[model samples]
Each structure stands twice: as C-alpha cells, then as structure tokens.
Target: MKTLLSTNLIYSIMAKEAFVKEAADDILRLTEWIREVFEDGGKLLIFGNGGSAADAQHLAAEFVNRFLINRRPLPALALTTDTSILTSIANDFSYDLVFVKQIQALGKPEDLALGISTSGNSVNVVKAMETARAIGMKTVAFTGGTTRPGGDLAAVCDLVLNVPSDSTPHIQETHLWLEHVICEIVEKQMFGTT
Candidate 1:
C-alpha cells in the first residue's frame, strides 16, 4: 500500500510538471485574449459543470466583484448562478439547452463566452459556445488535454486554452490558477495599477 501511494504521488507530480512545461505559452495567449475583450468593452460570460461550474462562478466573481486588487466592477456573468434560470430552462427545454437559451437571450456581438470543461467536452457548454458563435460573440474554452466529444469547442473558439494534463484534479487546480492570473491581468489593464 505504501509503495502504491508513493507511485501515485510520483505520477501526479510528473503529470503536473509536464503540464506546466507545455502550457506556459498558451496561458500567456489566454491572458492576452482576455485583455483584448475587456479593452473592447465586451462582457464576459462563463459556465461549466460540477467543479468546473464552481470555477466558473469563482472566476466571474473575481471580475464582477474584485480580484487581488481593488477596482471598479467589471462586466462578467456566471451562468451557473440563478438557480431559477437553470432549473426553468432545464425543465422546459432540456439540460443541453440551458446555456444555449441564455446565450441567445443575453449574448451580444461584443461579448465573450468562456466555457470550462476538464474533459474538453460538455454538451451544454458546447451548445452555448455554438450559440455564442452564431451571435458573433467571441468564444474561449478552458479544457483538459484529452480529446472528448466537446473537444471541438476548442477548435471553434477564438481562443482555446487547454491545460496540458489529463488528470481531472490537476487540470482543475491549474484552471483555477489560470483564471486568477487572467483576472489579475484584466484588473490591472482595466483599472490601472489595481
């Protein structure tokens, strides 16, 4: 049992190291994209499922409320919030249409959509991305390295930031860090030295 635990730990470390080694450029690009969107006065809309859903809310809150520094509130929305909308849409149109319906209603041409999925696949997220694209909104995807059904979301998005790990836990950890870093950049760029 001890040996098994040690082996798993080693694997985890190795995987995290590999992800860091490969994802630096991607992270930088993602930050740039975020900066551009905010510079253009584009609203940011985010969504995901389960842990990713929590991440979506966390990131959006950082923007809409504040990140590391004090600044004016930015325009950001987390689709995971508003249980009324979620349950109503899920019941009326099916789970896959929840986000899509919201996008159709609230998305605008200058807005940005950010969808997070560890596996690069989430039907609802994909549907929302597609709707955002149709409405001329820019799309961004935070996804794991693996190719899943929702993997095409990355391809279609204006910017697809893929964390270079297949391990779900590690991928989520890195995603939170990336989200925080981007929020910091946005805060500084928008509010100046905040």
Candidate 2:
C-alpha cells in the first residue's frame, strides 16, 4: 500500500513538473487569448463532461465572481451549469448539441469557448469547439496526454493545452493548476493589479 501511494504521488509530481516545464509558452498564449477576450468585453463560454464540467463551472465562477484578488466580476458562462438546457438539447436534438446549440445562440465573434476533455476527444466538446469556430469565436481546449500534440479537439481550437499524463486524476489535477494560473493572469491583466 505504501508503495502504491508513493508511486501515485511520484507520478503526479513528475507529471505536473514536466507539464510546468513544457507549458510556459502555451500558457502565455492562452493567457493572452483570455486577456484579449476580456479586454474586448467578450464573455468566456466553458464546458466539459463529468469532472471537467465541474471544472468549467469552477473556472467560470472564478471569472464571474472572484479569483485571488477582489475586482469587478468578469463575464463567463459554463454551458454545463444549466441542466434544463442540457437536457432539452439532448432530448430535442442530441447530446452532442447541448453545448453546440448554446454556442450558436450565445457566442459572438469576440467571445471565447473553452472545452476540457481528459481524452481530448469528447464529442460534445469537439462539436462545441467547431461551432464556436464557425461562428468566428476563438476556441481553447484543455485535454489529457502529451502524446497528442493536437487531437480531434485541436482542429477547431485556437489553442490546446494537453497535460502530459495518462492518468485522469493527474490530468485533472494539472488542469486545476492551469485554471488558477489562467484566472490570476487574466484578472491581473484586466484589472491592472498584482
């Protein structure tokens, strides 16, 4: 049991360390994208499945409410927050249309869509990214595994951040760290504070 715990801890630690090393440039680009959108009064539309969905809502709340510092609320919406819309879209159209339809209706050219998928291939997220692109909205994705430079989710997203690990927990953990980093940078840039 100790060996298993130690192995898991080491795996997570090494995965995060490698991600931090490899992701500096990509992180900069993503922060810039968020900065541009917020500067332009564009909202962020975020979504994902399961834990990623929860992460989407968490990130949105950070933008809409507060992150580390106190400031005016930023505009951010998580498509996964509305169960009625999700169920309606799934029932009336299809499960894949949940986020796509929302993006089609709520998205604008200046807005941004962010999708989080551990496998980098969630169909609904891929569809949402595609729709957001066709609408001229910028798309960004947080996905798992470093092996896929750009997976199916990459075809539409303007930026893709893939955590360099196969373990879902490790991927999600790294994603949480990135989300905090992104919110902090965006808040600081938008509000002009530390």
Candidate 3:
C-alpha cells in the first residue's frame, strides 16, 4: 500500500516537472493571450468531455468569479454546464456537434475557445475548435503528450498546453493545477496585484 501511494506520487511529480520545463513558455504565452482577450472585451468559452468537462467548468468559474484575489468577474463560460443545451445538441444533431453548435452561435472573432482533452483527440473538442477557427476565435487546448503531442487538438489550437504524461490521472491532475496557475496569473495581472 505504501509503495503504491509513493509510486503514484512520484509519477505525478515527475510528470508535472517535465511539463513545467517544457510548457512554461507556452503557459506564459497563453496567459498573455487571455489578458489580451479580456482587455479587448472578448469572452472565453471552454469545453471538453467527461473529466475534462469538469475541468473546463472549473477553469471557467475561476475566470468568471475569482482566482486568488478580489476583482470584477471576467467574462467566461463553460459550454459543458448547460444540461439542456448539451442534451439537445447531442440528441438533435450529434454528440460531435454539441460544442460545434455552441461555438457557431456564441463564438466571435474577438473571443477565445479553450478545449480540454486528455487524449487530445476528442471528436467534439476538435470539431468545436475547428468551428472556432473558422469564426476567427483564438483556440487553445490542454492535453497529454501521449497522443502525438496533443493529437488533432494541438493542430487546431493557437497554444497547446500538452502535459508530458500518458497517464490519464496524472494528466488530469496536472491540467487542474495548470488551469489554476493560469487563473492566478491572469487574475493578478489584470487586477494589478502582481
């Protein structure tokens, strides 16, 4: 039992260390882009599936509410939260069009779209990113390096925060941490707390 727990911790730490080393610059770039979006009166739309969906909602809340400081709420929305929309899209069109439809309706040239997918190949996520691109929205993705360095998601995104891990658990954990880091940096920079 002790060995198992220690091994898990070690793997998680190693994965995070590698990711930090490889993706630090990308993180900074993403933060700057996010800042620009807010300054230019652009909103952020985030989405994903399963655990990634939860992470999307969590990050959007961090942006819309607060991260580490008190400030005005930023404009952000998680496309996964509305059960009515999600089910309606899936039932009416297809599961793959769930996010694509939303993007078509809400995305704009000044907005940004963030997709989270551990495999970096979630059909719905990729499709939505493509739609966002067609609309001129900046696109970003959080994914694991296992799937050809973020698979199709990386190809569509302007920035890809690809965690250096194939393990779903580790990738998801690191993704949450990375999202918080982004929120903290954006919050501080925007509020002049940094």
Best by TM-score: 3
Tell me the tens digit of each residue's lDDT in model 1 across 16-52.
Answer: 5666677778667767767777778888899999999
Q: How many residue pairs clash in each candidate?
A: 0, 0, 0
Clashing pairs in 3: none
Clashing pairs for predicted structure model 2, backbone only: none
Ranking by lDDT, best first?
3, 2, 1
Clashing pairs in 1: none
Off by over 4 Å in 2: 192-194
Q: How many residue pairs clash in model 1?
A: 0
lDDT of 3 by residue, 10-65 (tens): 99999899999999999999999999999999999999999999998999899888
True-vs-predicted CA distance for residue 185, candidate 2, Å: 1.4
List RMSD in Å for every model shown.
2.5, 1.4, 1.0
Model 3, global lDDT? 0.93
Cα displacement (angstroms), candidate 2, residue 56, comes to 0.2
